[model samples]
Target: MLAESIVIIGVNHKTAPVAVREKLAFSGDCAGPLLTLMDIDGCRECCFLSTCNRVEVIFVASDPAVAAVAVRGFLFAKSGLGDAEAQQYSYLYQGKEAVAHLYNVAASLDSMVVGEPQILGQLKQAYRDAVEQKTTGVILNRLLHKSFSVAKRVRTETNIGGSAVSISYAAVQLAKKIFGSLQDKAVLLVGAGEMAELAAEHLVRQGIGRVIVANRTLERAAKLARKFNGTAVGLAELTTQLAEVDILVSSTGATDLILRKDEVKPLMRQRKNRPLFLIDIAVPRDLDPEINDLDNVYLYDIDDLKNVVDVNKAEREKEALRAEGIVAEEVVKFGLWLEGMELAPTITAIRQKANAIREVEVAKTLGIMKSLTENERRSVEMLANAIVNKLLHEPMIFLKNSTPHDNPQLKLAFIRQMFGLDKESPEQQPPRENV
Candidate 1:
């Protein structure tokens, strides 16, 4: 069987800032073309995972060596970086290393704030995209399904996700600072997406007085509002809602500033000198930075929220260790599965050879026994089949039970030679790992 390998080439919060990650992020429309391009370059099975904090290409390849170089080259091209610069920000993992890295990512141990839940959903979406593109094959399919199971185990068995460790959670903490207690504060959520919804949900749990959801689409805002027992408002209503809201959380997808100095200056006066707490978790920032200079108006962007998360992260460290153990266990189990899979072709070849020999011998015996009835011929063939099964049973068991780590190719060759199945038949080999 041709050796197959899994490779992970990525840049995450640890390796690169959000700026670099955002540059590499692939939209749903771009993923198909990007993966198809990789396929054309000999990627066997691949998936692209791009989230707010990371961008990674996890793929199976025929040659790990070649794939590593190809992946780095593609990333550099995508990032518009020279070789040295790209290497400084990117990370590469091969074989078992790649598996362990993915396991950690899926389990959220690799998140900026460990145990944050959003990354898992993002990864699942990336997998779905790969599936839709028809780029994922059996090996990746099994790997991902197993990763999902591992993530579930980690979530249930450990307290990793119990703490508030996301930037959105930090935004909630900031809200508490503005009013001293969130239970009596009216909040306005400036977006209806996951981050905004997460922020709103956290505020609700803290016993907020009221929540208002605003978005580009009224229907989406309405959905979020209904989910939280809040009021829904169109984006156009944000200015009017500003006066009524004591706390504002913004996590919009706009390319530019949504709340400018000019618009917010009047809203502050309209509030009659009341304090306004604004949290902007958006990439480009929904709220203008200049608004922070206003009287009794406090503004925190995504970076400021990270400071709050930093204080909470220590609580999750011990739980993260437990989650790490789960990830390690899953990685080993997956490694064993991959090993057994790699040996499958040799097993198939041996079985096919054994069956062919039995057939040839059985036919010869049947030809010599011309006087025998059809029923007798059938009995002879059945005996041949039983004999073949008995003869091959122990060898099959040995192949399955043996560890595939110490020179698997040598072991496979030995088995093929012993069974007289060493003929060059590509089709009889195990499925290709590298495309």
Candidate 2:
């Protein structure tokens, strides 16, 4: 039942370009509000995951068809795309397909760059956000927990994660070429954004010393600093800090340059010609392009990092094939589990119906044998119940293993015919019929 309760609607790098994906990106901070806007009446649980390569919503809905439509409509409205464009670039998966897609995403098989490690962390953050918002229920809770475990297992058991991979690590490698050794190197991080945090973590892990975070918002800067045990400073203080810092990594959302050549040129004079490594990971570029021309200052943008990432991409694809086999095996196992869950309710209903019929027949017979002792009537009822259970046990076992994919309509038809229940029960019937 939990497995059948899931629905997923999404657009990814495979389906759309960066320009389209950027429009759809949830940006994490505002996902709670966006989820609320998209929440349909029957949707009991929801989680939104948006990254550079993909934007997907996972939810539990009482009516998958209706909820899928609502989710699609929401995406279209949010992105200002027409229904035709949305349908062309988006996909909807329900039940087992949705679960498999999530597992593959968590395992990194669905990533733009295969075996990229960032997706697992992003998925975890999305799940955590949903949990904090109380939008995730038992079904999503179990599903996400399992996804984490599966990702960990895939990483540890296979050579996928060990292979040359990751855009962030590649960025660090490019930085190393400019600065031979990062040990005791002072780095200034220019944004409190997620990519800046990730780059800061990588730099810290590489034994960089004296990490300073500078942001327009000092609070956000301080938060990022606290995370890596670094110091926080205001953006206005960047010029004073620049002369002291060896590396500068900027990834801000500002519409304009946070660091211009005129600003850093004065600081370069005060630095006594110590080399400053600048890695501009931002899309709009936080640092001025002119900074690259200054003496003893090295600048590398996202395009530079992409070159090394492209080489690793080929190597990662080789390892990903092996990882893909592992994912396929796990997918089959999860699918079997899901199929078993779908059969549970039908099996339960059949057993209950059989027991009720047996009870009614026994009660009718007992009314005729009113002269008999009370103990005799009780014994007969017990025997009748046992006989009915024994008769239906084998069929119940068979149905439990049967899957909807194998015979989609047969199972429902067989259950209905056997129980003498209507094809559509009154509770499930139209409102007009009830009226």
Candidate 3:
């Protein structure tokens, strides 16, 4: 039988703040556990996407309502948010709507700053994480691969991602605004993750001198340090290196602040207040919120970067109408496919039921007319087959054209029960029409 399958739940910048988002963020280490949790009962396939701006759980389930509720409860419990808070901010989508949402997200249409390119990479990482954990099955694999293709199509065919509107790029721009030139600035990258790498690359492109990468894992830190030809140090010594660094960009996954106000206060004294610029891109935030109060320490959190992102967002919104039109076109095409899937089994059963009845009637007539010529029996059989095909032609066409709005599945089920085709028949035949 054809089954209803699709993504059920998601949460992003639109639904939650960075603090709330970070609490639900799934790390590489947590992928296995999260996948295990999603595999319980109703969930069929799963992928967890975690980035600075979003923490979404994508799944294909037999029951979307049950799956959505379970996912929402899990997120709220893990994030320590009240049920009311989750209900207030969280959004739920099912079936074709959910698929459309994911396509836009992967295509960067729903990004905080539309057409920002980093989201595609973040989605790729999420897919990889799911694959590594062995949680994503056939449905999720196909969905993600198709989503990637759709994103590529939108980027290549349209002017959406043609410009850079990402916060990382904006951070670089903001840095330039503060300091006339970045040529002699020292940049400290406090995490070896993708975000830090992106910001560090952007800073280096602007001729920044001496990049440093610090992380809890020395090997990972060294790998990134080597890529930029910079120094790598244990995160424990981050406070000591703070004084010498001119620009600090921290995106560690640590649950607490790496650079508290007290820690940065002494560093300010040592640098003689050399105007340290700190960008806290992490969810829980690598730098303390209180650090903004310290003299000479300028701190910019995820929200602080919004002003820069908003300027880009406004420009992109003009092109968004065009992009949204593209998404709508694609969504309708997908919806048709989903509708066709619903009719598939019913159509198969109908053909089977008709063919079985025709065969039985043909055999009974042949047995009763054993004295008739062979040509006569052959003609009767052919006539019966033609009659069955003619009788089913219109219903088959109707099934193919039906939409979800018409409750295609319920209609198909009713047809199956009415024709006594709900149960399998020994003389079943394959569906003649290709879906």
Candidate 4:
């Protein structure tokens, strides 16, 4: 029943736009928000996760509805949104659904780019912060750890992350196919924007020998180039730079083509027509499409890269379905554990009570028959144990059944009251649940 107390409240890319997400996203260490969550009444255990695409609070609460409302308010504290608007833009999951949501997020099935690996690391960091703050207790500790293992299983058991799923990544994959190896290759990144920056990063990781960043403003070009320990050149140097690099990734905001076919045609002659790979990831098309017609010059635009992503995305979706199956299986396993937790206290109470009574009755009998031998006393004690075991057997089976047709909470309550377990000691009383 404690598992039924688990709650997750947050806004993700699906539920809220970027403007709202940025306003509500937490930055820096999670200590502040984690401590705040622990401060909320009935919030027993908690962890906080905030990334570029999502910000979520996962907590177990004795009062789930009230705690959820408080958490939603805390999340929207800086968003300039009223409670009604906040609720409209955010989502909440409780009990089993909350567990499933976390597992999905850990496995990256809920990611903006479904197989992206950054989110898992982000979640781990969030968990570490919670642990350091001492905000997580038994329930959250097991749940978060289980989520991590589920993510690992998904990664190992499926091909979810084995292919390119982004435009920048697809561009690098195409270049790899063309060049066979990028270890000795040089890349020229045109336009120092996010896409170009990402492509440059991917190529550098592939051991591209050199990187050249070219943009209209030399300052932005130099900034992006410095990140890869590469060279920076002005747009004026495109032709000269084009002759040197083996690959060109152009993603500029220019209204017209930044690199025309005529401009690149002559560059091919300068390099003795060494094979060139060109990728235009810009919206308005920075590189001319006709550049592909040039001998040994391969050009792919945004749509070309998208086609690659689409194919890979289909593969990831198939893998994701398998990942979902894994999550469902894990959820049921965790539910069984929670159910055992539900049954444990009452069972322990019943056994302890029965043993106490058996010991007293056996000792009294031995005291009354003072003439009995030691072996006779042992026989009497053993008979007392047998009777206690036989009396408790049926009740234990009743508690363990836990069928869908049964009400476990009612059964536990009935057993505790019938045995007078609650009246015996306050410490031994089972924890109260709303249900």
The predictions' CA RMSDs to the true structure, in order, are 14.5, 15.4, 15.7, 11.6
* Clashing residue pairs found in predicted model 1: 44-435, 61-434, 62-434
Q: List lDDT for all candidates, in order.
A: 0.80, 0.77, 0.78, 0.88
For model 2, the superposed segments whose C-alpha errors exceed 4 Å read 1-5, 25-27, 30-38, 165-205, 209-311, 342-435
Q: Which candidate is the best by lDDT?
A: 4
Give per-residue lDDT, candidate 2, residue 12: 91
Clashes (backbone N, CA, C under 3 Å), per candidate, total 3, 0, 0, 0
**Per-prediction TM-score to the true structure, in the order listed:** 0.54, 0.51, 0.50, 0.69
Off by over 4 Å in 3: 1-5, 166-200, 203-315, 343-435
Better of 2 and 3 by TM-score: 2
Candidate 4 regions with alpha-carbon error over 4 angstroms: 80-82, 179-181, 190-195, 213-227, 232-244, 250-275, 281-297, 343-435
lDDT of 2: 0.77
Q: On residues 249-289, what C-alpha lDDT tens digit does candidate 2 reach at each position?
A: 88888878888888878887788888888889899877889
Order of quality (TM-score)? 4, 1, 2, 3
Judging by lDDT, tell me the better candidate of 1 and 3: 1
**Candidate 4's residue-wise lDDT over 1-435, tens digit each?**
677799999899999999999998588878999999999998988999998899999998889999988999999999989999999999999888998999999999999889899889999999999999988876787789889988988887899997998888888888888888899999998899988888888888888999999999999999999999999999999889889899988888999988888988888889998999998889899888898999999999888878989999999999999999999998987776555456776687788889999888988988899998889888888899999999899989988888787745557757766888645223233347542
